[model samples]
Target chain A: MKKTCPNPAFLGFLIATAILVAIPGLSYVKQRAPETIIPGPGVTRRGSLSDYLPALKGTSADTPVFYLEGKEPGGTVLLVGGAHPNEPAGFIAPLIVVERGVAQKGRVIVVPYANGSAISHTEPLEGSPASFSLKNKAGETRVFRVGSRLSNPLDQWPDPALYVNEKGQVLSGSEMRNLNRAFPGKADGSITEQIAYAIMEIIRREKADISIDFHEASPEYTTVNAIVAHEKSLELAAEVAMYLEFDDIPITLEQSPKNLNGLSHREWGDYSDTLPFLFEAANPFMGRLRGKTDETLIIEGKDPYYLAAAKAKRLNVPYDEKGLPLSYRVARHITAFRYVLDTYNTYYEEKAIIVTDLPEYEEMAYRNLGDFLN
Target chain B: MKKRVFLLAFTLVFAILVIANGPAVPKLAEPVMITTAGQSAGAAMMKVLFTKSNIKDFVFEKLVTADEIEGYETLVIVAGASSKGLGAAGIDFDGETQRVTALIEAAKKQGMKVVVAQIEGAARRGTSSDQLFSLFVPMSDWVIIVRDADSDGFFTNLCEEHGIPLTIVEKSIEVSAQLNAVFE
Candidate 1:
C-alpha cells in the first residue's frame, strides 16, 4: 500500500479561503467610526485637546475641538457632547452645530466626542448594537457609533473592588471609567481621568464664560428632559427654562446639588470660572424596563413595555406608541442650546454670544434631523 | 477466549453505569413569585407619603421614596392622614399633621418646597369609615377627588367645605396628564 502525503499547496489555499470567508464577519466586529464633520463657513480654526495638555497628545482621548469665532470678539462658550457615549443626542447635537451653526457675535467651541475611547465599545451586559445609520436628505446614509457609557475596559482594566472618585464619591468600581464622574480630573490619572483633565484645561485656558454638557437619561428616570444647572448658573437656567416652556418644549430646571462631587456641573463650576450646565433628554432604550436592546430601540426610541409602563403611570416622560424618536431628542437639545445662548446674550451684553443657522425644535422635528446634517 | 470474555464483561458494566446517570439534572429550588397590581384610575397619582429621613425609613414601608423632596417640588401631597392600620394604631390624625408640619419645616431648611395633595375618592376596605378618611385624605398636601354624576355632590361639597383644592380627573389618562402638569 502507498502512503499519500498531504498537499501543502492545498492546505495554504484552505487557510486563505478561511481568512477570506471571515473578512466580512470581522468587518462587522470592527467599530464603525462616525464620518468627520466638515466645519462650516463659520469655523475659524480647529485644534486638538492635546494642544492644552501634551500628556494626551497621542492617546485615544485626544479629540478634535471645532472653533467658530466672530470678528466682534465677545464671550466664549464651550459645548461638549458624548460625555456618556451611549447618549448619541448629546454628541449629535454638537456635531450638527459644528457642521451648520454660524457665529455672528461671540465664539462657540464644540467637542463632539469628549470621551473618544468610550465610543470604541458598547456597554457590557446591555446587548446594545454598536452603530446605527440615518439617511440624509440627499439619500446618502450617515452612520454613527452607539458607544458604551464608560471608557473601554481594554484601555483601563481590572476595576477596583470599589471606586472612590476624586471627589471622594464611593461608586461601583466600573464608574471609575465614566468620564462624567472624572470631571476636573487629575492630569496624571487613568485614561478617562486624563481626558477629563484635558477638557478642564481647555475650559480654563479659554476662560469659557459658559459651558454646557449634553446627556440623555432613561424616560423612567425623574431627571429626564430637564436641565441640571450649577448654583451660579441658576438665573440663566431659569431664563432658558422659561423660554423653552413658552416654546412648548416643557423643560424643567433642576439645581445641581452641592454635595454631588465629580459631576461635570458640580466640578466644572467649583474648579473653573465657567458656569456649567447639563442637559438630559429622555431615552427609553437606556431604561431598565426596555425590551430588545437594539439599534431600532435606540434610534426609534419605541418599546411596548415602556408604553405599558407609561399607561400604568410608572414612567416620567410621556410614552405613546409614537415613541420618543431620535429627531425629537436631538431637537430638544438643539432648542435648549439656542435658549441658553439667547439667555447668555441677555445677561452679558458686553460679551454676547450669538449664533445663527441652527434649527428650532419644531423645524427640526418637522424636517427631520438629517435635513440639518451636512 | 478468556481475554475476549473479560473485555466483553467490562464493556457491559460501563454501559450499565452510563445508563444509570440520566442527562437531565434536577432543579435546586422553586422559582420566585412576583405580584403585579392591576391598573386603576387612581394609579396615575401615587399618594406618596412624605416623611423626614428618620420617619420616612419607618413610615413609607412599602412605597418608594423620592431621593430628595426637591425632586418633586411641584408634587402634591395630602396631609394629616395615615394608612388604615397606621391610623387605627392610635397614630393620631393630629400627630399626622405634626409629621407633615415637621416635613415642611425640614423641606424649608433644605431650600425645598412642599405642595399638599388632596384625596378625591374614599377607599373602602371594610366597615371602618375611618380607613377612608384616615388613610388617604389628610396626609396629602393637595387633594384630588373623583366625582361621578351620581355622587349627589356629597364628596365635592365636603371637599369645598374644607377649602381643599380639588380637581376632578374622570379617566386614568386625565389623571396622568394632571399629575404631569403638576410635577413636570
Candidate 2:
C-alpha cells in the first residue's frame, strides 16, 4: 500500500474536464425552466395537454392550455403557438394573447408552448443565442429561450431512416421530431407524435370551430406573409385577408393543398371538424441570406443580405432598409388571429368567438412588443 | 403668402384630376360568371369584391367550364397562376390553359363581355402567371389589375398592344369600387 501521490498533470486534466462539463451542464439545465406565462383576467380556467391525453401526464411533452371562456357559451377556437420553437414570433404572439386577450363571446384556447420538449434545448451547432430578453410594460425584464425547431433528441432518440407520417407523406428522418409533420399522430408513437396526438385530441374533444397555428418563415420562402387555409376554411380565410387589406396589412391567401399531408392546415381539417388555418410572417433572421445569427437579428430582423436580395428580386416578401422587426411580425400574427375570429363570428354568428383587448397592429408595431406582455 | 400658394397648388391639382379623369371604363353586364384561369385565390377575392360591391347577379364558380358560361352575360377570368392551386384543382398548367381558352372562346361566341383581372399583386406574378396573362389579356374585352401587379408595366403594355380598356387600381380593395363603376 504505497499510496503514491496522484499525478499532478492528471489532476490538472481532471479539474479542466470538470470545469468544461460543469459549465455547459449548468447552462443546459438552466434552459429547462419554461418561460413564464401569466394568464389575463379573461382566462377562466387553466388546463394541460394531459387533460386531453392522460399518457402525457408529468411528461415534458405536456404543455399549458389557457382557456378564455366567455360568460355566454358558444363555439371553441383553438390557437396554437411554438409548434416550432425556433420561430420566435409564433411563440411570442400567443403569449401576448394569453396575457392580454379577453374573450367577449364563445371560447378562446391559447397554447403558447405546443411542444414543450422543443423549447427545452437549442439546435446543435447553429451558434444561436440561447435566450433573448424584453422589458414588459411593468419595466421588468422577461427572458425567453430561443429553442430548437425539433424536439430534443434526449426526449425522443434515434431518428428513423425515413419518416412516413400518419398521412403517409414521406419526409426526411429528422422530420420525425418535427411536430408540424406529425399530425393525426398515433397514441403510441414517438414523443413528438404524442404531442401532436394531444393537440388533435384538444381540437376533436373541444369541438373547435376554428383552429389557427401561428408560424414564421424565412423572408425568401415562397409561403412568407401568407395564410395557408384548408379548403373548408378558405372562405373565412379569404374574408379575413380582405379585412386585413382594409387595415393596410396586405397578406396573401393561400388555399391549403389537399396533396400536402400531415400539416396542421391539412390534417387538422381532414381528421377533425375544425376548420384549420396557419399563418406565416417573414422573418429575416430565419432567411438563408441572413448576415449574422444573433439575438439582435432575431429581435430587430435587419439584415443587409436580405436588403441586397430584395434589390435583386430574390426574396418573396417585400424587404427594405426599414426591415421587418419582431414587433411587426408579432403584430401581424395577432391581428390576423383577431380577424379570423371576427370573420368566423360573422359567418357563424351562433358559434361566435369574439375577442377583445388584443393589441392593435399599428400600436404594437410602433411601440415595443413587450409592452403587451405581462 | 405661403397659404395662398398652397391653396392655389391644391386647387390646380384638383382641377387636373377632375379634367384628366382618364379613359372611360367600359360597362360590364350583370349576371356575371366569375371563374379562375389559373385557379389562384384572386378568384375568391373577386367573389368578395363582387359581394361587397353589392353586385347581386353574379355567380362564382372557381372552375367553371365552357358549357357553364351559356347563361351568363359577362365572364370575369381572374388570371394569376398558382401551382399549388392548380394541383389542388387536379389540373396542370396546360390543362388549365385549354379549359380557360375554351371557356373564353365560348363566352366570346355568345357576345358576352369578358373582363380579366389580376388582384394579388407582384407575389402572384411569375412566368406561369405571365403566360396565363398573355393568354387571357389579349383576348379580353377589358382588363382590371392592381398597380402592384404591373410594376414592370407588363399588364399595361399588353393592354396597350391589345387596345383593351384597362383599369389600374392602387390596391386590391379598390377593385371593389372599380367593379361597382363597371357594373352599377
Candidate 3:
C-alpha cells in the first residue's frame, strides 16, 4: 500500500466513506415504532373515513375506522377522537376501545383521528413538542404527535377577517379553522368545514343511535372533567353521571346551551337523529399554569403551578402530587363511555350498544395503561 | 502545496465572516404608544390593532389628557366616547353639534390623527346616541366599520348620510394594514 498509494483524492474518498459509516452507528437512537393495535374479538371489519366521504380520500382528513358488530342485529353507535388533537385522552381512549373492546350486542364504530390533519401538526406558539412516546408492558413503545386545536394552516390558509358559523354567529377569524366550530359543515366550504360536513353526513347515513366525541380541557376551566350533552341526551347523561358518582369518579353533567352555535354537541344533535354526547377530561398540560411543556407534563400531568393553584383553591379539578396522569384521564373517559352505553341500553333497549373488555377506572389507575395495551 | 493550503484556510475563514455579518440595516423599531378610550366599545378591535400588519410597536394605555397624548401619533376613539365618559370629563356633548367640533379642533391642535372605529353589536353594557354622534361620527377623519352593516345602527346611518370615507374590515388582522396606511 505504501508503494502503491493512490492520489490524495482517493484517500479523501476513503476518509469520507469511513466518516459516513461511523455517523449512522453513532447517531442511531432507539425510536419506538407506532403501536400495532390488536383489535379485540368484537371487531368485525376495519375501514377508513374516506369510505364514507370520498372527498377525504388521499387527504390527511382520511383516518382509520374500526367497526365492531354484535352477533345479533341492533342499533349502531359512533365514537370519535382527536377532534382537537392536543387532547390526548380524546384520541387514546378510543384507540384503547378499538384495540381491546368487544361489542356484544350492538355495533360500535370508532374513528381514532376524527380530524387527521389536526394530528399532523402542533400549535406554533404553544411551544409544544411534536411527539411523545409511551412504552407498553412488552417494552414496545408507541409514539404520537401532539397537534393543534385547529386544522393545519397549510391545509387551509387565508383565514377570513371574520368567521360566521353555520348559526350566523360571528367569531374571531381564526376560529374558521376549528373543526369543532365547523359542525354541520358545508360541502363547498373550507377543508375543515368539509371535514365537519363529512362527519355529519356519516352520522346521518349511518343513523348512529348515539354519538360520543371524546375531548379534554384545561384543568382551570369550569367545564373540565365534565360531560356536555345535547338537550335530548341530558337524561341519559345524568344517569351516567349518577352512576359514575357512586364509583367516586366525580363527573359533572352539563347541558349544551341553545345559543352556542356550531359545536359538535349542539349542531350534531340539531342536524342529526343521533344523541350527541361530548366528554371532557381534566388535562393540566392544557392549563396556562403548567411548567416545562414536555412528554412528562403531558403524560404525568404534574405541574408545580397547578399544585399551588390547587392549594389556593383556584382549580376546578382537584389536584395532588399524583397528578391527573394520562392513564387516569383515559380510564375516566373509557368508564364514562361505558356508563353512557349502559344507560342507553337501559332507556332504549332497541338501540342498545353493549361492549366489553373496557378496564374500570380503578384498574387503570392501579395497574397502569401499559398493562392493557397490546 | 503548503502555501496553497494556507490560502484556502484563509479564504474559508473570510467567507464565514462575511456570511455571519449579514446585510446592513437599521435595528428593529420600538413599539408605538397606543391610548384607548375608557368608554369605547371596541376592546376586540383594539386587540386587533396589535396583531395586524408589520406594525409591531403598539403600547396600550387608557386615554388621559391632551398632555398624555405625547409619544403617540394617532388616537383611536371608539363609539360611545362622548356620552359615556367624555361628558363626565367636562368635554362638551351637544348631540353632534358641540362634541364633534371640540374633538376635531382638539385633535388637529394636538397633531394627532383621529381614527373612529365603528362599534359592532351591542355594547357589553349600554351606549347613548350622544356618544355615537358627538364623539365618533363627525370628528373622526377616518372611520373603520365591520362588514356587518346591521350591527351598529347609529354608526351605519351617519356614514351613509354624510358619505364619510369608511373602510370595511372583516378580520382584526386588517387593522395593522389600515394603521400602516395611515402612520407608516
Candidate 4:
C-alpha cells in the first residue's frame, strides 16, 4: 500500500522556483524574435550584415540592412541606428527611414539595428521594460525591443580588465562590448568587435560617401542634441548646423576628438573614405535623473527629475514640462540627415545624395510618433 | 504744449544715450586669416560664418604659423582650449601658447590687425582658454566673443584693461551678422 503524500512546503517552493525561472526565461526568449519591419516603396534591396562579413551569418551579431536605390546613380549614404539600443529614438529613427524614406538620386543604405545582439536584451539592474509598443498608421500595434548599451552578456561575455581598441586607445573593459567603441573592429575579435568589423566593411564595400550614426544621451550630457563630426566632415556638419539653426533647432556642432579613437565618427573617418557624422539627441529615459522608467517614459520622454534638473541649470539641452519626446528626437535625426545629404549634394555634386519622402521635423515633431511607424 | 516739450526732451535724452552707448566698434580689415589658438572647432564655425557673410579672401588654418599670415591683413585667433584638440594636434598647453604667441608676434610685426575671438560660449571658457585669451587679448585690437563667454565679465575686464574693443554677441549664430557688420 504505497500511498505516499507529497510535502506541500516543497511543492510550494518548487512552484515558486519554476515561476522565477520561467518569467525571465520566457521574456529573454521572446526578445530573440526580430521586430517586424516593412520596407517602404523606396526599398530596392534587403540584405544582412553577414553579406559584408560572412562570419556574422547565422549569428546574433548580424542585422538587417535596407537599400533604397534611386533611378539616377550617385553616392551611397549609410545611415545606422540602434548602435546603443537603450536609446529608443536611435532605433526608431532608422525604422522611419526604412518605412518612409525614398531616395530620389543617390542610394540610401539604412541599418536599423546595428547591434542585433544588443537589441535583444535590456541592461541588467536598470529595470527597463523588455519591449515597448506603438500603433502604426494602420492602427495595428507594432512592438520594439529596448536593449542594453552593450552587447548581451549571453552572446559576448568575460569582460577584460581593460579594453585596448584597434586604435590603441585604452578604455574600460565593459566598453569592449560597446559597438560604438568597437569601430574599425577586428575581424577575428569578440562578437561585438566582429559586428563592428561588419559595419566598417559595409561602409567600405558600399563605397559610402557619407556615414551617419544615430545616438541619444541624457539631457544632462554636455554633448546632448549635438552633431559630432569627423575632421573631414566638419564643413558639411557646419553647413547642416547653420541650416538647423535657421530652422530654430539649436544643436551643438562638435568636432570628433581625434585622440578619442574607436568611435563611429572618428574611426569611420580614419579607416574609410566616408565622411562620418554622429548625431545625439536628448533622451530623458536614459538620464540618471529620470524616475519611473517605463514604456511611457521611452515614448513620451517626460521625467520630473529631468524637469528639476533643468530648473537647476544642470542640463545641457533645454528641458521643460513638455519633455523631449521620442518623436522630437527622431525628428531631429531625420532633419539632420536630410540637411547632411543636401549639404553634401551642394559641395560634392559628383557624389551627391538626394533622399526625399522622409518625414520632416515639423511633421514628425508635432504629430504622433506612432503615426510614422509601420 | 508742456507735454510736447517733455516728450521732445525725453526723445533728445534717449537719442543722446543711444548714440553714447552704441558700439563704436572699429571695422575689421579684409583678407582675414582665421586660426584657432587651441585648435577648437570654433575656428571652423567662424570660417563657415565668414563664407555665409560673403567675406572675401579669407584663409582658415587650424594651426596657422606666423609665416602663413603673410597675405592676411587680420589674424583672427579663436581663443578656446580643447585638451583633446591639443592632444590630437600633438602639442601641450605650453607649446600651443608658444605657437600662438609666435603667430601673434609675427602678425604684429607684419602690421596685421590681431583679433582674438571666443565664439563657442561659456563651454569653451576655461583656464587654458583664459590663458590663451589673456596672452592674445593684450595684443589684440578687437575681441569678438559670445555673450555667454563674457558672463563673468572676464572678456570685458580683459578688453578694458588692454583697451581692446569687445563685441559680445547674444548667440554664436549671430556672430555672422556681427562679422558682416564689422567688415562693413
Candidate 5:
C-alpha cells in the first residue's frame, strides 16, 4: 500500500502544471538576459554605463554605449534612446544608428537602451507582447524585446509612496523608476537615479555639445510630433524643425519651462554645458485611445480607436486608416537627429560636427528599417 | 555692354542708397531693448533670444524702464502680463500700465523704433495681456505675434488696420530669429 503508484489524474495534473510553468519560466529567463546587438563597422569601441558609475558594475542597470569616432577630432553629441523602453521606435532609432552609422568628422555616442532594467520585463497590466519580429532583406527575422516604462520591480523595489526628485519636485511614487524623471541624478540614490547620474556623468565627461533624448507619446498627447528644448538649445531645435518641415515632416518646437524640473530637456541643460533636447513621436499603444495593447499596435501604430478619436478631433496628431507606422516615427527621429547635428555644425564653426551614413528619412519611411541594421 | 554697365551701376547705387538711408530696417547697429509689460515668460524668451543671435548686441535690458528706454534705439514691448510676474515685480495691473505707458512714451520721445511682440500665445491673449496689447500694438511701428495668440484674427486685423508690419510665428521658439531680423 505504501509503494502504490501515483493516481493517473494526479500525475496528469502535475505534468500539465510543469509544462505550463516551464514555458513561461524559460521565456522569463530569456527576456532577463541581455539582448544581442551586433556592432557595425563604424563602431571602434564600446563601453558600459558602469564605466561612468562603478557602483553599477555587474548590475542590471548597466547598458552598453556604442562609439563611432572620426579620424579628425571635433565635437561630441550624446544620443539617448529607450529611456521608456515600451516605446519601441525610440530604441530602434538609436539601434539602427549603432548598427549602420559611421562618423565622418565627429564623435557619436549612442545609448540604445538607456534603461537596461526596463528592458527585462514588459509593462504590467498592459498585455504587451514579450517580443516583436523584424524581417531583414536577407529573409532573416530578428526578434526584439518589448520592454516596460518603469524599472522592473524585481530590481528596484518598495516605492516610497512619493518621490522628491533632484530638483525637489514631487512626483508619484512609481515615477521614481522613470529614467526621464531622474536626470542630473544623485549617485547615492535609487537605481534609476544611479542610471541618471551615470548619463549626466557621461555627458559631462565626453564634453557633449548637444545631448538628445528620444521618446514616444500618445497620439492624443498635444506634445506628440514635438521637440521640447531647453532655452540654450531652442535655436538648434528650431533649425531642426525648419528642416523637418521642408522635408514634409511637420514638427513643432516647444520651449521647455524652467519650472519643469527633472526632465531630460530641463535638467541636462541646467546641470551640464550640453544643450538638451527631447523629441517625441506618436505611438498609439502609448495613448489612452489605443484599441489593443499588442505588438501590432506598438510596431504598426494602427489602432482603430485612435482613428475614431481623430475623427472626433480629440487627437493632437493626424490619424487615418494609414496608421502612423513604426518606420515613420523612427525615421522622424533619425532625420531630426541628422538635421539637428547639421544645424549645430553650421552655428558652431569651431566645433563643427559632421556625421555620415545616417539612415535616410525617405528610405526609412518607405523601406524596411531592419534592412539598415547589421 | 552699355546696358549691362548701366544696370550694374544702378545696383550699386541702390545698395548704397539702402545702406545710407538708414537700412529700411529699424535700428540695426544701435542698441535695442526687450522690455516685458509684466510677463516673465516673455523675459525668459528675451534672454534666450539674446544669447542665440546678434540680438545680444542690441538687447540692452530685458525689463526696461523709462530711464532705460532713452538709450535704446529700438524698443520691443513684449505684450504679455502675468499676474504672478506682476506680483513678483511688485506692480499692480494699473501700476504696470502706467510704467509701460511711460516707457513707451520715453522710447518714442527718444526716436526709438517700437515693436510689440505678443509671443506668449493664447493664454496671455485674453488676460490682462489684452490691455497691454491695446496700448502697444497701435503705438508700435511693428507687431510680432504667435499664431495661436490671435485665434480671432485680432492681432492680424489690428496690424492691418494700424498699418504695422506684422510677423506671425507658428511657435514662440522661432521668435528669436525674427527678433534678429526686426533689429536689423
Candidate 6:
C-alpha cells in the first residue's frame, strides 16, 4: 500500500529537460575535437608545440607548428596567429602564411592556432558562429573554426579572484587563460601558461630573430590598425607601417608601453633576443557598435551600425560602404610581415629574411581570398 | 748647411699652402631625410617605397622647413592631403596648404632638386588632396605618379605638358628601383 509510482507529469518534465540539455552538450563535446589543418607546399616540416615543451604532450593544449625553410639558410621568423581566437583575421593570416608562403632565403615558422584548447569552443552567449567557409582555388569550400577569447575552462578552470601573471601584473581573473597575457610562460604552469611557454621555447630553439603576434581590435579602439612594438622593434615596426601605408593598407605605429607586463611583445623582447611586434587589425565585427553578429559579420565584416558610427566620426580607422573584410585585414598583416623582414634584412645584412610566393594585398582584396588557399 | 736651410724653407712653404687650401675631400652621395610638409600619410608611403635606395629616405611628418632643406641633394614632396593629419598637428587646411607650398618654394629657391610624387590611388585623389597635388606637380622638376592615376592618362599628360619626366609604375613599390636610378 505504501509503494506509490512517481507522477507521470514530473517524469515527462524531467525527460524534456534531459533531451533539451543533451542535444547542446553533445554538440559541444563533438566540437571539442580539433579541426583539420592542411599544410601547403610551403610547409616543409611540421611538429607539435609540445615538441619544444614536452610537458604539453598528451594534453589538450598541444598545437601544430608549420615551418617553411628556404633553400638558402638565413634568419628565422616566428609568426603567431590566433592569440585571441575570436579574431578571425589573426588566425587566417598565419594560415595563409603557412599555406602560400614561399621561403625565399629565410625560414618562416607559423602557428595558425597557437591556443589549441581555445579553438575547440566559442565565446559563451555571443551568438558567434562556430566556423566560416571559403571557396578554395578549385571551387571547393573549406571551413575554418572560430573560437573563444580564452582557454576553455574545461582545460583550465576556477579562475582566481585576481590573476597576477608571471610578471606580477594583475589582470581580471579570466586573463589567467589569455594566451597574450600568459606569454614568456612557465613550463609546469597552467595549460594556457604551458602553451605560452611552448611558444617561447620555439623562439629559443629556432633562434627566431623576429616574432609577430597577430591580433584584431574593435574599430572604435584607438589602437586599431596599428602596430604595438617593443622599443627594440620600433624601427622594424615603423618601417612595416609605412610599407603597408604605401599599399593603402592604412597602418599606424604605436610603441609598446615598457611598463605593461605579461604581453607577447613585452615578454618576448625581455626573455629572448627576438624582436617582438604585435599588430591590431580593425574588425567592426568585434566592436561594440556591431549589429547582427553572424558568419557574414565575421567573414564579410559589413555592419550597418559601424557605417553609422563612421558617419558620426566615432571610429579610429576608416570605415565605408566597402567594409573591412577578412581579405583586407589578412593583406595588411602579410604586407607588414614582408616589409618588416625586408627592413630587418637591410639593417642586418647577414640575416636577410626573404619570404615569397604569398598573395599580394591588392589581389587578395580585389580578386578573392580563396584564390591563394590550397 | 745652405742646401739644408733652403730645403727646410721649401718644405715649410708647401705645408702652409696645403693647410690654407684645405685637403681634397672626396665627394660621397649622402643620405637625405624625407619629411612631409603637411604631415601627409603619403610621405610615409613614399619613404617606404624609397627604401634600399641611395635616396637617404627619412620621414619627418612635421612641416619640413626651408632651413632643413638647405643642404639636401634632392627633395621628394609626396603631394596628398590628409586633413585629419593636419588637424592633429593643430593646423587648419588653409594653413597646411600654405606651409607645404612655402616649403616647396623654399626648396626650389635653395636649388635643391625637387621630385613631386602622388603615387596613391584614386581614393587619395580627392578634392583637397588634388589641390595639394596640383600645387607641386607643375612646380616640381620631375614627377612620379602611380599607374592607377594614369589609366585615363591624366598624370602622364600633365607631366608631358609640363615637360616633367613622368614615370608610371604598375604598382607603387615598382618605382623604388627607378627612384634610386634618379638619385644615381
* Number of the predicted model whose DockQ against the real structure is largest: 2
TM-score of chain A of each: 0.93, 0.97, 0.90, 0.97, 0.96, 0.95
DockQ of all predictions against the true structure, Cα-based: 0.02, 0.50, 0.01, 0.28, 0.10, 0.07
Docking class of 2: medium
How good is model 5 by TM-score? 0.78
Q: Name the lDDT value of residue A266 in candidate 1.
A: 86
Return the clash pairs for model 6, or none: B34-B58
lDDT of 4: 0.84
Interface RMSD, all candidates in order, equals 14.6, 1.3, 19.7, 2.6, 7.0, 6.9
User: Once model 2 is optimally superposed onto the true structure by TM-score, how far is the C-alpha of residue A201 displaced, in angstroms?
Assistant: 1.1
Order of all candidates by TM-score, from best down to worst?
Answer: 2, 4, 5, 6, 1, 3
Cα distance off (Å), candidate 6, residue B163: 32
Error of model 5, residue A84, in angstroms? 0.9
> Candidate 4 chain A: worst 10 consecutive residues by lDDT?
A241-250
Q: Is the docking of candidate 6 incorrect, acceptable, medium or high quality?
A: incorrect
What is the C-alpha lDDT profile of model 3 across A307-353, one tens digit per residue? 99988867767689989999999999999998888768866887778
lDDT of 4 by residue, A1-374 (tens): 99987899999999999999999899889988898998889999999999988989999878999999999889999999999999998989988999898888889999999999998889889999999998878889989999899999888889999999998989999999999999899889999999999999999998999999999998877677888889999988977875676566767677888888899999999999999999999999888888999999988889989888888878877788888888899999999998888778877898788888888899999568889976
Candidate 1 per-residue C-alpha lDDT over B26-124 given as tens digits, one digit per residue, 9 for 90 to 100: 111111111001111111123211110011211111122233343323323332122322322334444444444455555446544333332212221
Point out the worst 10-residue segment of candidate 3 chain B by lDDT: B19-28
All candidates' TM-scores?
A: 0.69, 0.93, 0.62, 0.88, 0.78, 0.69
lDDT of 5 by residue, A1-374 (tens): 57989999999999999999999999889888877788888888899999999999888889999899988788998999989999988999988888888887778999999999999999988888888878877878878898999998888998889999999989999999999999889899999999999999999999999898999998877567877788688767756764565466756556676666678998999999999989999889888767667777766788888888988867767678888888999999999998888778877867877887877888888467678776
lDDT digits (tens) for residues B52-122 of candidate 5: 55565555343467886556677777767655456445567887788878888888888888878875565
True contacts kept of each: 0.00, 0.47, 0.00, 0.29, 0.00, 0.07
Tens digits of per-residue lDDT for model 1, A1-374: 99998799999999999999899557545753545576878888999878877888877777889999988889999999998989989998998899899999889999999998888888878988878888777887888888889998877887888888888988889889999998889889998889889999889999999999999999877567778777678657755664564455645555566666778988999999999999999988888999998888877888999999988868756679888888889999999898888768766899999899988787876345777887
CAPRI quality of model 3: incorrect
Residue A293 of model 3: what lDDT? Answer: 93
Choose 3 or 5, whichever is better by DockQ: 5
Better of 1 and 3 by DockQ: 1
Candidate 6, superposed: residue stretches over 4 Å from native: A1-11, B1-184
Backbone clashes for every candidate come to 26, 0, 3, 0, 0, 1
